[model samples]
Target: MDESTGLTIHKSEAVALTQNGGLAKAIKPLTKEIHLFDTYVAGVSYLKDKTVLQEIKIKDRLTLQREDNKFDDKAIVVLSSDGKKLGYVPEKDNIIFSRLMDAGKLLVAYIIEIKKRSIDYQQISIGIYLVDF
Candidate 1:
C-alpha cells in the first residue's frame, strides 16, 4: 500500500536491506553484473525493434566540455530536424548513439551539474559535485 508520501515503506525497507552493508555488500557485484546484463538486453531489443518512421536529420554536433577541463572520449549532442530545436540527449550515455544520429536539430552545448552523495561507516553523508556534459 502507498504511504502518506506516496511511497511504500516496505519497499524502502527492502532497498535498505540491499544497501551498502551486509547482504548488499555480498551481492553488490552480482547486482552490477545484472545491471550490465539488463543494459545489454535492452540495447539488443532496441536494435532489433526498428520503427517504421520517417528519418529526422540533426543540423550540427555540439561539443561537451567539462568544468574541470578533463578530456573525455564522449560528448552530449542536441539534435533536431525541420529547422526546429529539439531536446538534447546525453551522447555515449545512451547505448544507441548511431540510432539517434538523425533524430533532431542541433542546439546548444553546455556543461550540466552532476551530484553524488555517499554515506560512510559513521553514517555521515558526503556529497560530491561535478559539472559534466
Candidate 2:
C-alpha cells in the first residue's frame, strides 16, 4: 500500500454484540434460541483529498470559532498504538496524522472541547493510511 496517497483499508471479524448490562443473560433463561440481528458498515475516513468527503455541517461546526487568542494556552495530546503519549499538536498547525489498524488492536482518539474566547485550526484535515499486509 502507498502511504503517500493517504488511504486506509482493513478487514475485521464480527463478533456477538452484547448489552452493557446483564440483559442478554437474563433473557437467555426465558428463551433457548439466539438470533442474529441487523448489521451495518462503519467507514471512518481521515484523508484530506477530494475523494475523501466529510459532512459540511460537521466541518463548519469544527471550525466555527476561528481566533488566535482562544487556543493560545490549550492542551492537545497525541497518542500512539501502545497507549503512549506522543506529544501535542498546536491548534493551528498542519499535521499529517497516521495510525496502524492491526487485526485486533484498538484505535483511540480523545478530544477535549473547551468553550473559550476564541478558536482556530490552520489544518482542518488529517491524512490516514492502512499498511497491513
lDDT of each: 0.27, 0.28
Give every collision pair in model 2.
67-119
Candidate 1: which pairs clash? 79-104, 79-105, 80-104, 80-105, 81-104, 81-105
Cα shift from native, residue 9, model 2 (Å): 43
For model 2, the superposed segments whose C-alpha errors exceed 4 Å read 1-72, 94-133
Model 2, range 1-133, lDDT digits (tens) per residue? 5598877755332222244555656555654322211111111122223122222211121111111335443333333333333233444431222111223322223222222222221122222222222
Task: Give the number of colliding residue pairs in candidate 1.
Answer: 6
Q: Which ten residues in a row have the lowest lDDT in candidate 2?
A: 35-44
Q: Per-residue lDDT tens digits of candidate 1, residues 1-133? A: 5766886545566577666675756555553111111111011112222231123222222231222214423333232222222222333343233223224321232222212222211111111112122
Q: Candidate 1: lDDT over CA atoms?
A: 0.27
Per-model TM-score versus the true fold: 0.16, 0.20
Clashes of each: 6, 1
Residue 92 of candidate 1: its Cα lDDT?
Answer: 35
